[model samples]
Target: MTVRELLTEMKDTSEVIIDLAYASLMYNSSTMAEKVRGLEDDMDDLKFATRYKVLLSSRTREDARQLSGILEVASAADRISDAASDIVSLLRFPPEKRPFITEMLSEADEKIRMIKISSDSSMVGNTIGRLQIEASTGCKIIAIKNRRGWTYDPEDEMKLRANDVIIVRGTDDGADLLVEYAAGRKEWEFEEIVPDDVIEDEAEEDLQNEEELSEEIRGEGDEE
Candidate 1:
């Protein structure tokens, strides 16, 4: 199947899985497992399509591996969604118990802040550890989208290469700091005037690093 076809199938199957999870949460236990089984079947079909696309395409092995990894993540997400719904179902206790449950859910949801980072930015070149340090100084890089559209976890150790968009979770001030950092401004210098010499030196260092990294990669390729 074509990439579009595979993607469409994946989307459809994913929706089915979501629907099953919702149904399980809203309905009785007698029928919940059956619906979950059907969802599992749909997930299997998605995996099959993903495998077929990877195996039949002329893409490089690395590309295929990446695609496989994405499918695996999707599968895992589906499972987690199902589990979350199951937990939600358990919260269907009497009215007295629901207030506490509602408060817990609200607290859980409120703790997370979602902010997207533009793909084209200096923050893309930084490592996760670097991003985390920046976050601790008040900007959290919670997730990232690599070129393949797969989201990277905060601690994945995958360097934030250019063209990767990131999602940060933090307070409003923290998110603002992240945006400023992504735009190449330090938190402490957000409002301060940048000296020309500092800018020039940073630019020179960046260019030198780019050339060195390129040469290193090229040398590795040659050795291989």
Candidate 2:
């Protein structure tokens, strides 16, 4: 497979490993722990494959420079898998001393969700960075699962394909927007969601302006 495909698989795999690890801690299940450990082996294999591909693909200095980005992104995926292993290590701690990491994640304003890319998705050929999903919808892609495998936090050059499953973190609204957009059901548009405070401020300003306009009309009528 191509380098992008390998990276894509690596990224998706890493996300699964981390999430499985997280779930293990959540339920305190040895079964999930075993799954995480098994996935780590897959992650290791992908990492090596990615590294070999990068080296094989590069020729010139410029080529190496471009390839470096792939290595960095792959390394990042490996680090996440390693981190999952570290998190699983927490099981060794006494139940009383275990960290509530998943609890804290649940409290965040945004949540992670998986979205499937439609066959006709406009995002199919676009790289994650090029699609500008995060900037457009305020949703950040954390992982993607394609035919080759799962990849964690794909790089800028990781071109998307049809039927890819992407994991993203964002508010509910943002996640919905991304899901629709990726499915080609909606086009990209910036819809700013004003905060309650901003909405209140705008309403107050409008009321003041309306009052001033009314007074101005009354004054004009008197002058007339």
Candidate 3:
């Protein structure tokens, strides 16, 4: 991968690792901890690859000066991954010894939660951009999992489907609202409201269609 692509991957990977690492500790899941460890390995590999690319690209004094910043960013991302790995290391202790983890997470300003979309949800057919999920719910989607695989930092144009599992970060109230929408228990309301005239027009159209259907049925009865 090019340096830009590698850096993007590293950023996404590091962010995911941090969230997953804390989630692992909060939920007491060894599986999540193991995933963090694997990602840490990947981060290391990315760091090395990035350095190799940067070194090859730096051909002069000016090139070296410009390229140094990229290395700094890569090192920062690597340190973030390392910190995440450290967070998950608490999993090595016995459950009883680390009971405070969940409590600490609960008290945090932002909480990460995984929500599954229901088949009947209004969100099933909408793209993230159309939904304006963050604007309405105040929760930002971090990752999504469908049958195909996981998408981290999903794009605005990404469409939601039934049974897609989304990981989001937000306040408790925001999470609850998003959960309700995802479960089909609540309808989505956007900042842009349809004009009353437009709604009335639609209602009039439906009435006209119903009347036309009735007239057709009556004419058929007369023929009989």
Best candidate, lDDT: 3
Per-candidate TM-scores read 0.33, 0.48, 0.71
Residue-by-residue lDDT tens digits, candidate 3, 117-174? 9998999989999999999999988778888877666899999999999988889999
Candidate 1 lDDT over 1-224, as tens digits, reads 66556556565545444433332333323344454555566556666666666667647878777777766765665565456446545534644654654454335422233434445465565576644545354544434567666442346466777556654434566656666656556532323447999989999999999999999999897787
Better of 1 and 3 by lDDT: 3
lDDT of 2 by residue, 1-224 (tens): 78889899888888667766765666565665776777788778888888898888799999999999999999899899899988888888765676566566567676666789997777877787777777888877766779987665568789889899887777888988788888789865534666999999999999999999999999896787
Model 3: how far residue 143 lies from native, Å: 5.1
Question: What shift in Å separates residue 98 of candidate 1 from its native position after superposition?
Answer: 20
For candidate 2, the per-residue lDDT at 20 reads 62
Cα lDDT computed for each candidate against the true fold: 0.54, 0.78, 0.89
In terms of lDDT, the poorest run of 10 residues in model 2 is 23-32
**Can you list the residue pairs that collide in candidate 3?**
none
Model 3: how far residue 41 lies from native, Å: 1.7
| Model 2 regions lying over 4 Å from their true place | 99-224
When summed lDDT is taken over every stretch of 10 residues in candidate 1, the lowest stretch is: 21-30
| Position 16, candidate 1: lDDT | 42
